[model samples]
Target chain A: MTHLKTKHRLLADKAMLWIVCLFATLTAVPLFAILGEVLLRGYDQLSWSFFTETTPTAYKAMKAIEAGEPIPGGIANGIIGTMIMLGMAAIVAVPTGILCGAFLAENPKNRFSQTVSYLTDLLQGTPSVIIGIVTYMWVVVPMKGYSAIAGSVALFVMMLPLIIRSTEETLKILPASLKEAGLALGGNRARVMLKVQLPAAFGGIFTGVLLAISRVIGETAPLMFTALGCSFIRFSIDKPISAVPLLIWEFFNDPNLQELIWGASLFLLLFVLTLNLTAKYLAKKWNQ
Target chain B: MESVKPILEFNKTCVSYTKQTMAVKYVSAAIDRNTITAIMGPSGCGKSTLLRAANLMHELYPNIRVDGEILLNGENILSMEPVDVRRRIGMVFQRPAPFPTMSITDNVLAGYALNGIRLSKAEREETVERCLKSVALWDEVKDVLNKKGTFLSGGQQQRLCIARALAMKPDVLLMDEPTSALDPIATAHIEKLMQELQKEVTILIVTHNMGQAMRISSKSMFMYLGELVEYGDTATMFSTPKDERTKAYLTGRMG
Candidate 1:
């Protein structure tokens, strides 16, 4: 009878292990596949000139081939435009998001704070496309054209809710005892929040901001409507901006543009991957 | 006892957490300056609440309402700014709660930093050394001042908290079961430290251990439920408690 029970337990354990393996593979395979495909297909087109030159005009490409020289179109302009827009979005979103998060976490019962939290929750659930449409109506239409500034506004809206929610959750996990310790040491509420509570939750808040930046950097749909597309290199916020994601989207539809699409897609993928890896490294270091 | 003025005087002070529930009711006592007064009670008694009320630390709880007066150095502490009251009255909790993110030196100087009062680097170092030495921790932690405060053993952490409290130079020190989290040897060390510290600052300690109260306290107040059952010199209170509840509590017959 004991031998039979042991056999039954062994079968159960083996079944559980297989089930776990199946679930792990199901979750991991698609991510690995996408990464593998991008690295394999994208590396072939990447070059110094591809990163440093502008998009090749139809006439310019034919002329370059006639001269038997490499094409001059690089992603330098797109990279600059993307960096500028993301920087502007971060400047607008980070402080506002963190302050709102702190207020919501610290004074959840305040009537105005509760209303703000409710609205933020609603906004967080709103689709990114809807945010793009709203930004087009409010910012792009008002300016009488699509511009980098409008793209930044749309991206800021998308980033704010994510940052606020993550920051609030991190702050909420901090113990009441830590706050009390600060207060008991002759510190007022503001002092306690700034010096003790915020510092304690800084690592989590930073990771949230980094994650939000990564989420927005690859966004194409919103920028398509808000910033439109421009081949010219322009750095002004009021001008039409060309970012890697929008460039990749435009190039992917043209059979003749397929090679450039892979290169731009690789740039976007590497940018986001670097951000995620940096955030993970920082979170681990700060946790210690 | 010397006839110097009391450092803290509780005049018919009553503390209630909710409108319907009272934690401490109409307790009156005078704590002499530079002396140790221990409050002894069972688990549910109001010893800790009373100590918290004396420092105005109870004000942090929204629903807690305190009536009557807590006079500190002739000023009504209840009427003072909680920050200022806390500056003059430092509290050490049951557990050793040094800010886990900070080093031992930083934890000791937290009071100054949190208050936005900047001191010279030399002065801050002097304060940390003096406070650590006062708590008999300097010799042990002198080489590792930059180590995390939470890295210390349970007993050492409690002493670090004491040093942190002392760095603020508060006039009155309130300890809520400060040594309860420590082992017997650590508790003995703390008790001896308390005796030495009582010559410089007034101390009000809430303890569940009757033996500890009898050992270290000059004055002992016994409580039952929410009321003060007996208040006298420790020797007199232990030998001849005026109330039956006090006698019952000390005899281990009733809580």
Candidate 2:
């Protein structure tokens, strides 16, 4: 009887394993499907000029379509704008996030830190659309026009919670003995944090920063309200800008420019995928 | 002539994790300078707690209270700044922890770096060499000074931790079962290292291994249930413990 029961149980376990594998494959299918569709549709549009030139006007795109030629001009303006805004956001957010994370991790029981930690969670859960409107009111309105600075302020708000949470969590998981040993050496809290804890947590914090940038890179609603839209390549941050997602949205709106949509989407998707993969790889290498 | 004052003195030191329960209760003892003293006990016997109190490790936790005076060189350490007191004292934990981010040489010089005390290149080299030599690790790790200390073998890593502590040239070294996590050979290596280290710095070590206490320590303390049960010369305590609890523990009849 026992032998029979063991055989039945093993069969059940095998069935469960197969079911889980099927579900896992089902979950992965859409990711590959999206990659395949985007690659096929966008590969022809990619070229040297496609990356170098700014977006073509709707009239130019219509003229190109009538001539039976590929749309002339690329997403240089959007790419440059995204880079500038990301740089600005990371510059302000990284240090502030790390310090706040240190405070939260070091004082887990303090009432103020607990409140701040809770607020960070709430901020992370907030909708991107709401954040965009808030940025418009606080930044675009104040500056008297939509600007790259306003766009970055929205990205900064979005990135802050992620960096803080990662830094805090990484520091928290480290063996308490590490901190004790540092302190036992007579190192003050600040020096120990700077020299020991932060260095130890660098992998996780850096991964979080990369993940944060990837997270905000595809944001269109926030950029819509803050950066508005610019047709030409612009360098000055106080004026309007165009990001990759914004270009995709713009392409979606114009019938003649619709062929460029997949290219922008593919570029954004590939960039985010690479960032996520690099973050994972660096995290693994650093841990060892 | 009057006898020299003890290097470290615990005057009725008490450590309580809470307001109601005391982990260490009125444990009074004095340690002679440049001698090895072993604190032996079973698990949860407050031996480790007593050792941690000497270094003010209790300060990190908010609720855990350490009362009574811990004096170093006849000055009360409980009131002194934790950083100031810790500078004069060093510690090694059970598991070997050579800063993961640091190289072997940098691990040795971590105390200086953490204190923001810059050393000339020559002085840094000398201190690393001297400290590693004292821990018997200079020969093994000299070539891989740039490699991260985490790459070393367990015993070698433990020795590196010891070297890191020795680099500070502290007055007292508190070790909380530094060899407990090692294999027999590694444990023996640390035991032998401690014997040599005592000549330069006063050593207070917590161990559950009775043979280890008998092997290296000149003085022995046996604690039971948060109280110091016995304190005397090692030979005397091993041969004839005055307290019943101490004898029971040594004879393996009680924990």
**CA lDDT, every model vs. true structure:** 0.88, 0.93
Q: Which candidate gets the maximum DockQ versus the true structure?
A: 2
Candidate 2 residue-wise lDDT, A1-288, digit = tens: 999999999999999999999999999999999999999999888888888899999999999999999899999999999999999999999999999999999999999999999999999999998999999999999899999999999999999999999999989988898999999999999999888899988999999899999999999999999998798899999999989999999999999999999888888899999999999999999788
- Enumerate residue pairs that collide in model 1: A53-A74, A54-A73, A54-A74
- Minimum summed lDDT over a 10-residue window in model 2 chain A is located at A43-52
lDDT measured at residue B22 in model 2 versus the true structure, 0 to 100: 93
- Top of the candidates by TM-score: 2
Model 2 segments more than 4 A misplaced: B1-3
- Give the runs in model 1 whose Cα sits over 4 Å from its true position: A1-14, A58-72, B1-3, B101-103, B143-148, B253-255
* Candidate 1 residue-wise lDDT, B1-255, digit = tens: 454999899999899988888889999999999989999988878888899887777766677899999999889998899999998899899988888778999999999998899999999989999999999999999999999998999999999998888889999999999999999999999999999999778999999888999899999999878898889999999998889888888899986
Docking quality (DockQ) for each candidate: 0.69, 0.91
Which interface RMSD values do the candidates have, in the order shown? 1.1, 0.6
TM-score, model 1 to reference: 0.90
